[model samples]
Target: MNVLVLYATVEGQTRKIAEHVAARIEGQGHMVVLGDVRDPGFAVPGTFEAIVLCAPIHMGRYPEAFVRFVTDWKTAIEAVPNALVSISLAIHSDNAEERAEAEAYPIHLQHKSGYHPASVHHAAGALKFLEYDFFKRFLMRRIAGKEGGPVDTSRDYEFTDWAALDQFIDAFAGQIAQP
Candidate 1:
């Protein structure tokens, strides 16, 4: 099978997750093409049998570029076996409402873009304090403290569960391999 793993990232964690997804899908004996949605040359070549679209939620929404991409390619995207990896730090929150909000982001994106994915995976994002500017770092630390996440701004914290991600990939691969 051929798969396209595309992503839109801010602060870089979503890119990292997309790379990992591409590598894992390729490792499962499928051909994979990975690209950033913001790349000037990025295009869906119509050769992929499956796709995994990943994007992170910042503030309250996905990047405008990501929303635009999905809206533009809605028909082609929905024609294939596609999945969504919705990355958000709120997925790791101790509060149930936060987690629910994180899960609902993909739904909102679907409603906005008219691209409903076959499956949705909610992945916890990271807090890259080391990569943030002073203001962002301060704001993130405050939010982390309020959410019961690690508030140590001296380093970054990753909440992605690789094992769970692998399971999702494996299942998707299996679905694609079916007749």
Candidate 2:
């Protein structure tokens, strides 16, 4: 199948995840394209057999630019077999409250935008202090400290679960295979 995997990232974690997804799909003998939704000149082909849209949560919200892109291309995306995934720290949290908040975020976006995708995945994001400024590093470390993760600002951290993402993609592949 021809798949389009488009995403937007704040600190580059989501982009890496998206690339991983694309590589996996390609390895499965499918054609895939990866693009940033923020780039206004994104050349999405109309003949794509399936689509996967992804974005990372930042400050409790998705990037405004990505939201607009999805909203604007809702019909185009919906016409094909499509899925969405929201990456966030909440997905990594062991605390019930944090998980609930993270789960609610993508639902809220779906409700508000009225873009009901075939599948939705909430994957854990990362905290890369090595890529942040002083304040960002401190804030991320503080958040991580509360979540019982790494508090040191000298290194990076990732929480994405590849097995789960692969399963989700395989399911989509199956759906498109159905007659």
Highest lDDT, which number?
1
Per-residue error for 146 in candidate 2, Å, reads 1.7
Query: Which stretch of 10 consecutive residues in model 1 shows the poorest summed lDDT?
Result: 40-49
Off by over 4 Å in 2: 40-42
Q: Kindly give the stretch of ten consecutive residues in candidate 2 with the minimal lDDT sum.
A: 38-47
Q: Residue 156 CA error for candidate 1 (Å)?
A: 0.6
Per residue, candidate 2 scores C-alpha lDDT tens digits across 117-137 of 778899998889999998998
- Name the regions of candidate 1 deviating beyond 4 angstroms: 40-45
Q: After superposition, how far is residue 65 of candidate 1 from its true place, in Å?
A: 0.6
Shift of residue 102 alpha carbon in model 2, Å: 0.7
lDDT of each: 0.89, 0.84
